[model samples]
Structure formats: C-alpha cells, structure tokens
Target: MKIALLGAESTGKSQLALALSAHLRNSGLAVHHVGEYLREWCDTHQRTPTQDEQHHIVQTQIARVMATPADTVVIADTTPLMTAVYSQLLFNDHSHDDLALVHQALFDVTLLTGLDLAWVSDGLQRDGPHVREPVDQKVRHMLSQANLPYQVVYGSGPQRLENALFCMGRQAPQWAKQLARQESPTRWSGLCETCGNGDCEHRLFTGLLVP
Candidate 1:
C-alpha cells in the first residue's frame, strides 16, 4: 500500500508517518517511510523555496516515492499535492496541480492530518498558524475536485496513531487486525488472503516478508 499523508505545517504529518511506518514494520511488513522533501530543502537553503522552485520541490517529492522499492509499503510524510497547494496559496500558481494530482492517483490510501493540533512555529518551514486553515482548505478542495478518497486523521500522540489505524482498518481490515494484535505468527496468511493486495500476497509467497 502506498499511503500518502497530507496537511499543513505543524499538523503532525512527519510524526504520524514515522509512527505508522514503525507500527507496520513491527507487524512484519516491509515498509518505506518517505520524509517531506520540502522540509529538507528549506533546512538546507535556510529559506522557503520561491515560486519558481515549487515545481522542483513537487517533482522531487514524487521522485522519492517513485524510487521506493515496489514490494514495500510506502508511507509518505507529504506528497507533491502539498507543494501544489502551497504553490496556489503562496504564489497563486496552479501549474503544479495537474502533475501532483496525476501522481497522487497511484496511492492506495491518503490520510489528511487535521488542524486540531496546536500550531507551533518552525523556523523557515512554517508560515504561521494563520496559513494553516487556508492551506487545509486548499488541500481539501483540490482532493475533492480530483475525486480522490482521503481519510482525515485527528488527535495527538498515541490517540492520533489509533485514529489513523482505525481509518486504515476500514480500508484493509485483515491487515489492520494483524497490526493491532501484534501476535499470532499465522496472521500474515490471513492478512495476505483477505487484504486483496497482490504485492502483499507476492511478498508473502516469496518469503520477503519483513519482521
């Protein structure tokens, strides 16, 4: 499964991505966690990317996912759709939306982090609490317009992780059950049998399952 995490700054996308990846890995699944490329870029440059640089950021984010091994579950901290949203909101440019949405269609699941968490300023990365709502709204509108399905994740810390797991469970019940129980060595068979994921089934048969 390719899981995409989306939301404005300070909404816990990075935290949840790591937590989810850890949980899945603990449950014996091969997982790849992709961090937000834009964050690294900002930290390296000591400033936000310009309008002209947004496209590069978007493409690089997508490239990270494309480069991941196909047999692993990809949990992306943030997808290119975010950069597209920022481009529209910050620079009023909509060019990146087409490519971002096209790439987003490949993901099996999308989880949008809710704005309920308190916003904390991150130097060079976060604009302010004020931009959160606008960014959130833009993200929602774009996803809705594209007719892409996404679950909204809310809460903090462990509660937040549970909520996300619940949402994921709704999509793949057997897989979620195995992760939640974290027991029963034979649970992988059930998850692979009922999850309807061919790659997962292939991994199981090929003895590539990671524990």
Candidate 2:
C-alpha cells in the first residue's frame, strides 16, 4: 500500500517516514521511502522557492514516485497536496497546486501530522514555529475540501507512529513490537556508513528530537 505522511513543516513527517519505512522493511515488506524533494531544492538554493520553483519541487516529487519499483510499498514523506497548500499560503498564487488532488487519489492512505511537536528552523525555507499552526489549518482545509480520506496523527513520536498504524488498520511489525517493550529508548541505533563525516548516527524516533 502507498501510505503518505503529510502536513505542515516540522511535524515529524520526515522522521515518521524513515521509521515507518524501516519498520516495514524489517518485517520483510518491500518498502520505498519517497522523501521530500523540495527539501533538497531549498537547501541547495538557500531560499524559499518561488511559485515557479515550487512547481519544479512538485514535479520532481511526482517523478520520484513514478520511478519507484512497482512491487514495493511506498511511504511518502509528503504528498503533492502539501505543495499546493503551502503554495496558497506562501505565494497566494497556487498556480495549479490544486492539481495535486488528482494525484492524491492514488494513495492507499494519507496521515496528516499534527502541530503539537516542536518546530526547528532548517534554513531560509522554513517559516519557523509561529507559522506552523496556521499552515496546518490550511493543510487540513485543503484536504477536507478535496474529500480525501486522511487521519490526523498526534502525540509524542512513538505514540504518533502507533496512532498511524491503528489508523491504517495495521499492527506493529515484529521488530516494532519488540522495540516498544524495551525500556531504553536509545536501544535502536545505526550508523550511515556513507556519510563523509563517518558520524551519521541514526536513532529511532522514540521521541521527537529532530527530523
């Protein structure tokens, strides 16, 4: 199934996508985590994207999803509708952002992240903590208007994941079930061997630290 984690920025969508993908993969499920392409574009440009640039962000995201291996389940960090909603809020010129709804129908499930968590500024692209709630409302409004089936996930990081699984009518995978019983939150760990610093320590989202 194609499960999408979406909503306003810094709502733990990225971390949730990573955790969910990892959990599914551990369960012997073929999963592909389609990350947000706009993040890369913004980081490179060091500025919030213009309406024209936002289209490129959505287009690249579209291409990435299209390019995924057909047999694998997909967990997208954000749906294209996120772009449309943000576009309306930021540029006041959605510029075909509503077209994202056409693509939204393809997803098996969509999870909207809540704004109860901490917000961290990533760069010029972020609107910071204060803007999160209003943008979150916009996301909810847009999703409701489009008649999409979505579940709003809230709580601390681990609880949020459990909520998403429940919303999707899924139980925790074997590994996840085991992790949930553990007392030490830092028990889950991995290091990204490819990072140039060789210090890319990966931690499971036991709590929301940073995405």
Candidate 3:
C-alpha cells in the first residue's frame, strides 16, 4: 500500500508517517517511509527554495517515492502535490499542478492531516499558524478539482494515529475502538455529513465497533 500524507505545516504529517510506518512494521509488513524532500532541501540550503526551484523539488519528492521497493508499503510524508500547492501559494505558479496531480493519483491512500493540530514554527520550513488554514483550503480545493479521494485525519497524539489507521481500513487497537465508541455520535455526524462519502462513513463507524 502506498500511503500519501498531505496537509499544511505543523499538522503532524511527519509524526503520523513515522507512527504508521512503525505500526505496520510491527504487524510484519515491509514499510518504506519517504520523508519530505523539500524540508531536507531547505535545511541543506539554509532557506526556502525559489519559484524556479519548485520543479526540481517536485521531481525529487516524487522520484524518491517512485524509487521505493515495490514489496514494501510506501508511506510518503509529503508528495509532489504539496510542492505544487506551495508553488501556487507562494509563487503563484500553476505549471507544476498537472504533473503533481498525475503522480499523486497513483497513491493507494491519500490522508489529509486535519487542522485540529496546533501549528508549530519550524525554522525556515514553516510559514506560520496564519497560513495553515489557507494552505488547508488550497489542498482541499486542488484534490477536489482533481477528483481525488482522500480521508481527513483528525485527533491528537495516539487518537490521531487510530483515526488514520481506521481511514485505511486497518484495525486500530481495542482501546482506541472503545474510546471511539464512547465519543458522542454527534461529533462524527457532522464530519460524516460534511464528507458525504459512504466509504468514509463506513470506516469512521467501523473503527468504533468491536470485530
């Protein structure tokens, strides 16, 4: 399974990617985690990339994922789609959108980290808490425009990991399922209605029930 994690800065994509990879590995699955190449690039260069550098960043990000061994479950912290979104957000460049979307469509599961997590500053990488909503909106808009299916993962700490696992049709731990069942149905109702996807609804409720 190729799982692509997408979201605005500080939404915990890196953490979730690591958690998912570890969890799957514990379950005896071969996992290959692809970290965000842009972060590495920025760190090495000591600054954010320019508008002209976005294409190379996008290419390197997707190329890493594509190079992963096929026998392993690929967990991509961020994909080229994010680079495209950032390009549009920062530079107003839309040239990379088509290429990014084409590659993103190949992922088996695209999980959008919810804005529920508090935004944290990350040196040159993170813009600010103010940009989170706009970036989130842009990501959703792009995915919708591309007719891509995605699950919005919401929660804190371990709960967030459980939510992600549920979205992927995998069984979460027993205690997590119990906690989910204890949650007010009203909470999930609003989300379900908002999503309007039968599969998402099924997955949401399924994680609440004992098998």
- On TM-score, the candidate that comes out on top is 1
lDDT of each: 0.82, 0.70, 0.81
Q: Stretches of candidate 3 above 4 Å error?
A: 170-211
Clashes (candidate 1): 0
Residue-level lDDT tens digits of model 3 in 1-211:
6889999999999999999899887867789999999999988999999999999999999889999998888999899999988898898899999999999889888888877666788899988999888898899899999998887887777777776777765322342242344444332332342232557656655664648
lDDT per residue (tens digit) for residues 58-122 in model 1: 88888999999999999998999999998888788999999999999998888888766789988
TM-score of 3: 0.82
The best candidate in terms of lDDT = 1
Clashing pairs for model 1 are: none
lDDT of 2 at 95: 74
TM-score, each model? Answer: 0.83, 0.77, 0.82
TM-score of model 1 vs. true structure: 0.83
Model 2, 62-177: lDDT tens per residue? 88887889898889988788888888877887675557887777787778776656788777657878888788777777767888777666656666665566555432244244
Which residue pairs clash in candidate 3?
Answer: none
| Candidate 1 displacement at residue 15 in angstroms | 0.7
Better of 2 and 3 by lDDT: 3
lDDT order, best first, reads 1, 3, 2
